[model samples]
Target: MTMATVRRISECFVKPLHDLSQEAKQPIYFSPFELLFLNANYSQKGLLFAKPTPTENQDFSISTFLDDLRGSLSATLDHFYPLAARLATRKQENPPSYVVYIDPENCQGVKFVHATVDATVEDIIASKDVHILVHSFFDLNNAINHDGHTLPLLSIQVTELTDGIFIGGSVNHLLADGTSFWHFMATWSEIFRSNERDGYSISRPPIFKKWVLEGSDPIINLPYTHEEQFIERFESPKVRERFFHFSSASVAKLKARANAECNTNKISSLQAVSAFIWKCVTRVRRQPNKSETICRLVVSNRSRVNPPMTENYFGNPIQSVSATTTVEELMVHGLGWAALKLHEAIKSHDDTAVKKLVESWLRNPIVYKLSGLFHPNLVHFGSSPRFDMYGCEFGLGKALAARSGFVNKADGKMTMYPGREGGGSMDVEVCLLPVYMMELERDEEFICALESN
Candidate 1:
């Protein structure tokens, strides 16, 4: 476990193992969750805190600013090869492991590199100082891979512990997500505060194929008659919560009481914080005659599709959302049927109802086999002050914290973003069932006393 000099820097995309075919081979499932992986030896990496000591009065050269972002990481990986050739179902997953090798197989999704010291305790734990790749993908799965082509992922060694100054590399969360990884590190500090920007030239690249915003009717070909319906009646359920914090002026007074309970005068502060966490998870889990069926709540629809997802291709742009209940069924009918069923589920942003709900859950093969056999809990959402965490600078300054992650699924899997303060308010990380966000402020005090009427 002594590997460190990980200097492949970037641009290492591999898809041509003679471009395999036999109908484009993919189905490879060898689970047992790879016995929870763990290749050990972080060698005091501290995940991310005290190992990016770049100071010239806060201009600490996290190793020559990641060797100038790994020398413009292969022209920012040739602008994500037009989003892996428009989201390839072929063309060999559109290219990544751009030639850097030494894979030590941590599970197979390969990409791990480290180093450290301390960048002022990573600006004091903002987004837990950039989650050292969630314990290196919960102990290194398939040697860790963030799918670009073959292998290319994980490289976080942030150190600056009082000027022992060091900065490291290897990052490929498809390309970016954490608000487009601080919007490509603020477009590389606006061309590294430009002095005629050096070593990079990627002229336009981002279409990542999925038919350029697919959901008009695309899910690897989902058409089996509007699919998904295995209904075994709610099993391992538990993820029905709605937390609240409100006091940045009650989040602009609950975003004008969720746009006057969704009269749709337009809403965003993420649809009034997801209509106040979907009316406090329907008043803490709908029991009495339960089944009004309305808790989906996930939403990334990446700029409402159609040539929108640029900012360098990644994975799941998301969509589950359901929203509405007349600002929460006006607690037994009143304020105009709770603002018109919460304004027909937050103005039904229909792209053919988001492509027949992603082709009815990919033709509903029992929608994830009855949601992993009734472990149902899929109310996901992640907004994060719409990506702004003190401006994610990764050169070891800015991004004291901004959070979101995935892959721990079930027992209530959630992945909401934002809320590490100066994200300006609202924060979530939840895997919840460990409850107590103070039970969403005791049902947010009866909807802030019916919005002070």
Candidate 2:
């Protein structure tokens, strides 16, 4: 049972690109979350401050204690490197990396919370235990939280008062996919706690070369339009990471119905949720003579699908697979029709096919650009929260709630997880269109009532 008492900054780290000037800092694949948070503070890559767990023998200033902690932590690293990588502007082979600033003048030190380890877990797990509402480690005055955005603020408060340690960081989708980032955090914990070694044994090196994913395609020569310019300039449009909660039972019932109705194709809870969203959205949006509409559903390029992307594969391996239909077609056919469309996008394993499908828009500069801008009514639903929360003990009891932030963007996407042990029920806390959430919440209530029976 080991932990520190501090508020750590995840974003403040920066790795510098050699042979590339500061002008070329941003990479072409910049998304809305990356553009905003990165721009918020380039001077300090990220922020971190910690207070020593008060000891019976002695009390010390936060600054003095942090110095002791930093020395101990830094001693184990292979070499200090910046956490921020993937600059579109810098086309280079070698680069310098950076960690959060340590200058006392750079930011304020961590403030002490009144509670001690003496309190019960339930009592200390209270939101008031951590200073989430106050000044953010990564400049809250300059930052903003939206009802929509893929990159939201996160904090891991490790209090000296108890064996528990807070574990989380606001993740902008651009930095690293869930797979890579979580692995990094978990390893960091192992090193800090083991006290046996500076870092972990048999650790794999991180690859910061994100753009290399595209390879040398002749497609780079393609032309673009002004509309595309706006999209690229604005960043990818997708769901903001606001909470969208549905009951465990409603999702299960919907999945059962979806399976029975679409016997031709097996649909998971994901497909059913997508169908539900499409019907609910199309109903309210269809004004008078609205023609065909497009809904971009983000599919995680994971092994669950055919020719799956390896769990270790990082970067934006995800692609937007579209479901297009006329207003009449969607309204008349109901969930079965939409489920069929969704089912196709997720099925079958073929790297060439997935690459081709993604490249169709990705190669087109205009579409790629506009896809980032006006992805009107974009819906994101996929597998995440990967049930990894249960493993992030850090000496604390299981987290009562675990969620990632989406920088307040638009075109809502939401992911739902298994409810309390994959019990034919689902545990959902994700971003969605508030309008749809209201309707979905009602249905969840009904499902809950039925399940209680």
TM-score of 1: 0.29
- List RMSD in Å for every model shown: 19.3, 9.7
Q: Candidate 2: misplaced stretches above 4 Å?
A: 1-166, 202-250, 284-294, 302-309, 357-377, 382-387, 415-425, 429-453
Q: lDDT values of the candidates?
A: 0.37, 0.41
**For every model shown, what is its TM-score relative to the native structure?**
0.29, 0.58
Structural RMSD, model 1? 19.3
Score residue 364 of candidate 2 by CA lDDT.
Answer: 40
- Give the distance in Å from residue 248's predicted Cα in candidate 2 to where it truly belongs: 5.6
- Cα error, candidate 1, residue 94 (Å): 19
